[model samples]
Target: MRRVVQFSTGNVGRHSLAAIIGRPDLELVGVHAASDNKVGRDAAELCGLSEPTGVIATDDIDALIALQPDCVVYTALGETRPMEVIEEMAKLLAAGINVVGTSMVWLVTPRQADDWLRAPLEEACAAGNASLYVNGIDPGYSSDSAVFSALSLVTRARSVTVQEIFDYGNYDDYEYTGTAMGFGNSPDDPLPIAFQLGVITSVFGGLVRNIAAQLDVELDEVRERYEPWYTPERIECKMMTVEPGGLAAVRFAAEGVRSGEPVITVEHVNRLTSAAAPDWQVPPEGQLGVHKVIVEGEPRVEVNTLLSHPVLDVTEAGCLSTAARAVNAIDWVCRAPAGLIAADDIPPTEMIRGLMW
Candidate 1:
């Protein structure tokens, strides 16, 4: 069994705790919580596990590093404090501990990350002989990696498009839903993400670049597009309310074009409600969301990955899937070569730990 620890108790990290405890192949060693308030809490209680695992959550970075565990499943909030995440990741990597999770989506492809940011991690891997792998729902198995695997079926390929179409209403985080994504704001209101539109070239654009790299396609440049729709009527969610005429639906795409033609694309269709945009590609009845990869090529293949849960809604299930993505990659990442790694390099598994939810 691989000895492992978790970072943060957020949605992703909480689900990861359940996964790590339930898996017989993994041993829970420690957990890194965000604050002193969470310190000394049983890891099981933190994530609502049925039994205690003896491991406790702490905010002590030096103490956790002293243990020299195999890897740290980093699920902390990177957007809020990116520099802190990078610095901590560097600390862990330099301590000779492998790292994995959803902190930086752009790091999935090293080239997509800024040279200065990427340099320290590469140096850490070399110094400690440890590895780092980044994976999650949108930037993970559900996107570029999925598209890459489908290419093997085609004898000759033309173009590839990967999309994430989901209802954001299921997610109840007030800050994320309202502020970050521009939900419940007027159409003209500035969106945190839209203002940093060039940032797409690093996140989703990394997925596009990964696809192009594997297919051996030369993309002259990657482009970004953002389109939002306003709600025709007032809508209510668990966290916030969207008045009529407020932003309701958003379609963002990062395209990898070769010779003026889009050959690889990563797009997202997010909505507060299914009715927010009747004309757009909405979910089917009772379905939470759809992640698809369409290949406009010789075989013309397409993959629709639809996730639904009996207890949790779509967004929660997306969290579960993202957690699963990181948890499942733990073992593979530990055994992979040292340095920053890509999700595509990890082996694919159809069913992991029976997928509790």
Candidate 2:
């Protein structure tokens, strides 16, 4: 079993912890916790496992690196503190620990990442001879790999469009749902999601560039757009509450232009509830969320993935799937050559899914 450690037990990170324990080939060796409440707790206790693994959670970075784990599932938050995450990733990689997680979106395409950050990562990987791969459900298998796989079945590919339609009312975090996404703020409040156009461009831009590389086409520019919806009335869920005339839906889109024509695109239609943006894309019946990929080419092919389980709702299934994407690929990433890797470099899905939960 490959020695593995869970880094930060938050939304998706907690799922990574479960996935690490579920896999027969992976041995849970350590748990990294940032919250004071989580520190000093048993790994199993944090994850609600049947028995303790004799491993305790710690906030000491030195201690984690000293473990010399084969792989670290670094699922700590990076959206608001991206630089810190990147710096920590470099440290882990340089210490010879292969890393995988859903940290930064630019990591989806390492080549086009910011020079200052990407250069350090490259240096660290080269020094320690370790590898890193980062991805999530939407920017990951649900979109990039799925859309690219569809393109293989066609003769001539034209354009690609991937979409995620979700309702965040069931999401656990209120800060993210209310403030970061503008779920409870007034419709007129300036959304942080809208102001980060450059960041969005870099993240989805990588997906577009990867597609262009596969088709041997040059991309001219990448673009991002955001549009939000106003709540028609008061709404409440298990997580947060939205008042009338407050922000309810946020629609964001990114495009890759080639020869003045858009070739690759990713869109997210997020809602607080089904009634929030009825006109916006909604998943099929019985599904909490859906990821749709449409390739407009010869015999346009479209693929729709419904992320919902018998017990778990769409958000839960989606989060688990995202965690599984990186956790399942742990062995593949660890055994691969040292350096930044992408979906194209990964082995087949059947080979990567060594042990399913």
Report how far off residue 127 is in candidate 1 (Å): 1.5
Which ten contiguous residues of candidate 2 have the minimum total lDDT? Answer: 348-357
Candidate 2 to truth, TM? 0.94
lDDT of 2 by residue, 1-357 (tens): 799989999888888898788788999888999999999998888876878778899999889999889999988878678789988999999999999988877787777677976888889899899999888887887556888778877788888888888788788777654566767778566656634657567667677777677778878888887887888789888668888888878888788887877788888888877878888788887666788888888888989887767877778888788898788888889899999987778866633666644
Per-candidate clashes, comma-separated:
0, 0
Q: 1-357 in candidate 1: lDDT tens per residue?
A: 788989998878888888888888888898999787778999999888778888988899888999878989999978667788889999999999999888777786766677877899999888889999877888777665677777778888888889898887768776754577777778566665643658666668878877777777888999998887888899887657889998888888899998898888898888876778879986666776888888888889988888878987778888898987788888777888889887666556622534454
Q: Please state every model's RMSD to the true fold in angstroms.
A: 2.3, 1.8
User: Residue 49 of model 2: what lDDT?
Assistant: 80
**Which candidate should be chosen as best, given lDDT against the real structure?**
2
Candidate 1's error at 160, in angstroms? Answer: 1.1
lDDT of each: 0.81, 0.82
